[model samples]
Target: MNAQAPHRQRKSWIIWSLVTMGLALFVGANAHLAYVAFASQPDCVSHSKGSGEAHDYRAAKSAC
Candidate 1:
């Protein structure tokens, strides 16, 4: 019984390590995707045409 204990303990450690690594990877991926989604800016912009404060404005979407 004593001889088999070390092997069982090692197996358990490996399984737990793998589980922890998987969770970490999952969390990291989600964080990266969230950052990309929120940090990105819209390419569309509004431009003013004509002269003076009474100028007209035009809106267009960009290729971004």
Candidate 2:
């Protein structure tokens, strides 16, 4: 059982390492997406002038 101790510890360490790396990747991707969302400014397009129109696109309140 003593010889198996090191092997089990190594496996546990590998598993934890993989989990940490995956978590880091997920957090990094979310951060990048948030940065892009805040940094990018989209140009306004033509939209419906009147309200209560069917199948029409409405501009946002903060639209430029």
Candidate 3:
């Protein structure tokens, strides 16, 4: 009925909005997952007693 048309359309819009948000979130979270946790390729060799090369500097390394 015409009286309920607006409500249906509003509900559809909300559903679409939520779907879009979820899709964006999923894509954003997975987009770079393959590059996470795994160490990056070492640029140069490191051979200190307890030294190692920087592996994808996600954070600063402290001196050991």
lDDT (Cα, tens digit) per residue for candidate 2, span 1-64: 5999999999999999999999999999999999999999889877676677687767657465
Lowest lDDT sum, 10 consecutive residues, model 2, at 55-64
Tens-digit per-residue lDDT, 1-64, candidate 1: 5999999999999999999999999999999999999999867555654455655544344343
Better structure of 2 and 3 per lDDT? 2
How many clashes would you count in candidate 1? 0
- Which clashing pairs does model 3 show? none
Question: How well does each candidate superpose onto the true structure, as a TM-score?
Answer: 0.65, 0.83, 0.53
Model 3 ranges off by over 4 Å: 37-64
Ranking according to TM-score, highest score first = 2, 1, 3
The RMSD (Cα, Å) of candidate 1 is 8.2
Q: What is the C-alpha RMSD of each candidate to the true structure, in Å?
A: 8.2, 1.8, 8.0
Q: Write one digit per residue (lDDT tens) for candidate 3, span 1-64.
A: 5899999999999999999999999998886775674645555544344435554332345333
Which 10 consecutive residues of model 3 have the lowest summed lDDT? 55-64
Candidate 3 versus truth, CA RMSD in Å, comes to 8.0
